[model samples]
Target: MSRKLSGILNSMHEKNMDALIAVKPENIRYLTGFNPSSFSLLLLKDEPVLFTSKLDIEDASQSSKVPVEELKSLKDIKELLKGKIGIESSMTVETYKKLSNNFKANITDLIEVSRMVKSPDEIKNIKKALEIAEKSFEDVEFSGTENEAAAKLEYNMMVRGSSKPSFETIVASGERSSLPHGTPQVTEIESPVVIDWGAVYNGYASDTTRTIIETDKQEEIFNIVLEANKKAVSAIKPGVKTSEIDKAARDVIEEYGYGEGYIHSTGHGVGLEIHEMPSLSQKDNTTLEKGMIVTIEPGIYLEGEFGVRVEDMVQITNRGNVLNKLSHKLTF
Candidate 1:
């Protein structure tokens, strides 16, 4: 068995779970090498079996680290599942009813918890994704419409070997930058462009945000956000609470009289998915551990004015290591 599968099986054993039914694609991919493009189920026990629809059977057979089988129906899966079945927290209600009937079904996060730390291969993939994204950003000339800029950036990433843009590329410029999750519009590019983009390679992802500023006030706010980012990154270390890292950033922005404007969680874990566990928020108390990769992003939005944000991926060790090589300040 693969190391990941072994580790998960051990976790299940500890919980006295006879088997685990993983319905989430990422969770299934975490245990087996195959990433299901269609509906798939992974029954993990002493000998794990990956069941895929006929559409994916050929691919699953070739790529999976575990045994692969054609899924005839949920009834077949239900029969194989014996006593104390552990199910993922994100399982659909319909699936739960179909496959977990009469079994001791319990929702669990064992797979996600196992994925919190990065393996050496996973780290390498993430670093390569970052490289592709940063290189693409450098090649783009930020003078076109917001939509054009976003399309160009994504195109460059794919040419540089990203599987795809990790998420919707945000190219919010001028006043629109105030919207944290603003979508790129067809309007002409303006000063203070807030570009939050990422690249995915080998299923691992890299997320970052850089604002191109052109005014003294924008620079002032930019510096404050940068300091907050730095302080938060510095606060990351094994044994520290995720909330403390968040406070390190939020406190800096609050000290600058922009607490209310600092509207989101400080950051979140990133891996197979752009957003994962260990969210750096006031309520999350997950402890930092070596080998985990997360983002340290803190931004301030002035309602009628523009916004500025600087984000970088960080790896936890004895101290937090910033992964992006791009400069914090980007000017047009």
Candidate 2:
């Protein structure tokens, strides 16, 4: 907690922000160690305080590292705000309007920027999450409708100790697999089933996707996507720009003359949120750094047909160390 608080304080100092107002639940948990059920706020000054509602006061008092107080309204919170307030970009307009009277709001992502690089404990939780997710998937029976398959996978994750799936499990199969973020339907599971799933352990998340191929054409595209995934993972190293990693995978697909069939960025950071900073894409220029947990997912989406995606989590150290032990190619 001290390390996290100090990092944010130092960053706020550089920005000349007197304090940072953290309203996002994830940000609040990162700082205070208290996950709020109702509305809450963290005033990040030298002497930080967590202001939570009456419903959460008991929990916050017991769990929060910093002092916890009862908040009546935004007016009450405003009285505590000091010079040149720092706010997150995610703050809603209605809330911003209420807090924008006297203070000159500096739209900043101080906490998020700090969160981009994970700590030792955060890494541990992520590894545990991955373990749970992978273990749950190893025994799942993919012999039902897409929606049933999704439900079974989710139930398996919960029984294995995941608080919940990190996000909606992607169980796109057959032609529906062509949709990158497709929702599971009541139809029967088909060949080239794409299962994108995750598990949350102690707030950190593990995300992975694997496609089942049974036809020669599906195998062809699967090999291409697998090549792209492996090449992208191999190219990840400290000091390399994230865009370069995306290009490494994208180049493979483009060279195969299926560049147009490949959609979405190569990957993104995964921790508190499934999608976070340092996006691996053509535009993101953030350099790879140690202690960063990210996903490398490369896919080929063929319209009017099935699609294939292979994804895995990686921790950036001296080089990319793959966290997933599951094989890329899956039978049935």
Candidate 3:
């Protein structure tokens, strides 16, 4: 059995869980190398088994590290499950009902917890993903409409071996930049373009944001955001609370009197999923650990005016190690 599977089994045993029914796609892929195209379930126990749909069974068998079986129905597998069964929190209520009968079902994050601290291979994949994203950004021409620019960026990433964009590419400019999660529009591109983008490589993901500044006010705001990003990145290290890193950035923005404008958390983990565990926010108290990769993104949005944001990926080790090769100060 793989070390990851062994660790999860040990954790389940410690929790008095007899078996774990993993339905989340990422969890299944993490445990077994198979990325299911359709719904799949991994029953984790002494000898783990992957139950995949008929459509994916052949592929799953070829890719999965564990034994693969065709899933006929929930009834067929329900009989196999016994004792205290562990289910993912993301399991739908309907699905839970289908399997919880005659057994004690408890929501568990055993797989996700294991995924938090990346292995060396995982880190390498993330770095490659970041490289693809940054290189794509460098090749993009920020002319034409905002949507066109976004399309060009995405195309660049795909051609550069990215399976796909990690998330929707944001190319908001001018007043639209004031919207933190703004979508690229068809209107002509404007100054102070706020581009937030990422790319995926071999299932791992990378996230970054760079705002192209034009005027003095934009530069002023950009510098403040950059400072906040630096402070946040500097605070990343093993044993530090995620919230403290958030404060490190929040303080800089608040001191600059953009507290209200600085919406959203400091950052989040980046891996197979764009957003993962240990969110850099006030409410989350997760302590940073070595081998964890996170993003340090700070922004200030002025209503009806503009916004500035600087984002970079950071790896937590003895200290913070930034993984992005792209320059923080990007220009057209």
> Could you tell me every candidate's TM-score relative to the true structure?
0.99, 0.98, 0.98
Q: Candidate 3's residue-wise lDDT over 40-60, tens digit each?
A: 999999999999989998899
lDDT of 1 by residue, 1-332 (tens): 88888999999899999999998998888789899999999999998899999999999999999999999999998888778999988999999999867787989989998899989999999999999999999998899899999999999999999999999999999999999999999999998999999999999899999999999999999999999999999898999999999999999999999999988999999999999997999999999999999999999999989999999999998999999999999887
- Cα RMSD, model 3: 0.9
Worst 10 residues of 2 by lDDT: 75-84
lDDT of 2 by residue, 187-277 (tens): 9999889999999998989999999999999999999999999999999998999999999999999999999988799999998888888
Question: Pairing residues by index, what is the TM-score of model 3?
Answer: 0.98
User: Which pairs clash (backbone N, Cα, C closer than 3 Å) in model 2?
Assistant: none
| lDDT of candidates 1 onward, in order | 0.94, 0.92, 0.92
Give residue 101's error in model 2 in angstroms.
Answer: 0.6
The list of candidate 2 runs beyond 4 A from truth reads none
lDDT of 2 at 313: 98
lDDT leader:
1
